[model samples]
Target: MGPLIWIIDEEWLDYEDEIRVLEQAFPSCAIKKSGYDYRGDLDKFGYLADAIISQIYVKLDAGAISKLEKCKVISVYGGGYDRVDVLSANKRGIAIAFVPGYCTDDIADYVMSCILRANKPIDSYGSALNDRIWGLPAAGKLRHRIQGSRLFIIGLGRIGRTAAAKAKALKMEVSAYDPYVNEEAMDSMGVRKYDSLEEGLGEADYVSVHARLTSETEGMIGIEQLSRMKPDALLINTARGKIVREKDLVEAVTNHIISGAIVDVVAVEPPSFDEPIFHCPGIAVTPHVSYLSVESFKELKTRTAENVVKVLRGEELKDIASV
Candidate 1:
């Protein structure tokens, strides 16, 4: 019998066109599917899987990892794999793969869109016009011009570097804080490097986060960090939600500690009905989809299946998770 590959999660199933590609690529293998209802109980179906493709929401915790007796590869459907228990997967000699560079342009464009909104009266003015309010009273507030404004980015990974380049094109002064990235690299990109995050936030008219979610970064931007940002600074986070504590963010925006936030993620996905940030006036929240574009979507799906085939055939895989 051929290898059994389980493409778990209904989310991936929705991409019917993409699955057809996977079917063709693994013609000899039995490809199966499951609904969102199969989460936590992954072990029951996982034991027989030679390899598995998972959705971003599916948490392959340590217990779940222990049950994958025959699984050789785990292909995450997106850029971030924080939900996957990498340590356990590594201990068991399982290869975890992720599609990373595919989302660089998409995420950078999303962050740039938020930056443009920060300096424009587009939303407020359009809403007033829609309500038939004649006189442009909403235009009274002085908007920050994109040119000559300071933009600070936390974490200079692919997304961060891309955002910095875009900001520079708009004639904005760009600076960044990333311990992992060297000052020479930042200098070459024309981005000023800040020794500390506080120093970076203090001088910014806008701040964006692109850090990975790890022990060092979870709740990285709490009250003390938020307090350091300029009162009118606009904050953008397309990165992980846990990087910023939700309650602290609510308090900051509620009391106007920071002017507003453009958040594409939250501590929880589809946050509880009572998620206070939704009620906060100056915040814009998007369902964690910043890393999406038609092109990137196709790349992510194709690479996921390709990685599994490579592992099954004993070939070196691309973008092996830093687990």
Candidate 2:
């Protein structure tokens, strides 16, 4: 009998192959898979798990953490661990690990795709053609082009820096607002630094948000920030959802406060289909898949398993977020 490991899963079909990988990686440990509904439901497993691994949609709140009395580590298979209560887990002396820098390229690529999509008339042309409209004039017209467009990045972190490089490659003027980042670093990447977020919002034709979700950043882009944006600008958020208020965003897009928005996340994952933002023509929402790619997905799974193994062996764990 080896250490007990429990994998909180979404569905058997989804984790079929991933579970096999974990089994092969930790043949010395007994792994269990179960679904959790309520806060303390995971306590019914009857064994103190040595470690717990989960993907998105699994909320490891303080109550749930209390039930995992023997849990030594919590491994999250994603770039961000906002879904998990790291502070609470740390109080229990349980280390939390997340796969960072694994999805930087994927997220940056997705942001660029959204930026280009917002600037082009692809949707308008497709809709017009479906209606039997002919000719360029009837098809669609777009005044904003990708090249020479002003791009303002909200955070100059890994993803933000990658986005800046891509935007510059397209001949777009790139600027960023991150007081924590050094001005010399921004200049090296050909990005202008803005001391104030409001100034950047007022000047940008497109804004991409990559800031982490923390006490100071939650609801950072509320009504006042949105109001400062150009009426014809486009806003992109590939970072956390709560960083920008979803209700305010829906209102902004519906009222054309900004031309439109491309959001990969929202306040709630798998929001109701009847959500107002989904009904709006100007707002496009992806199901939090901006960090997805065949390569990144495989890496995330492998790294998560490795991290757990390291914890079991009492080795130094990589990407420790609980610190």
TM-score versus the correct structure, for each prediction: 0.94, 0.93
Instruction: Candidate 2: list runs displaced more than 4 Å.
Output: 11-25, 38-41, 139-141
Tens digit of per-residue lDDT, candidate 2, span 94-129: 889888888888999998998877766466576667
lDDT of 1 by residue, 1-323 (tens): 67888876655436564467656766676777776566444655657898888888777888878888888999988888888898899999888988888889899999889988777757667777777777646575686788999999999999899999998999999999999889999999999999999989999999999999999999999989999998999899999899999889888998999999999999886468578877888899987788888888888888877888788888987688864
Model 2 TM-score is 0.93
- Which candidate should be chosen as best, given TM-score against the real structure? 1
RMSD of each: 2.0, 2.1
Best by lDDT: 1
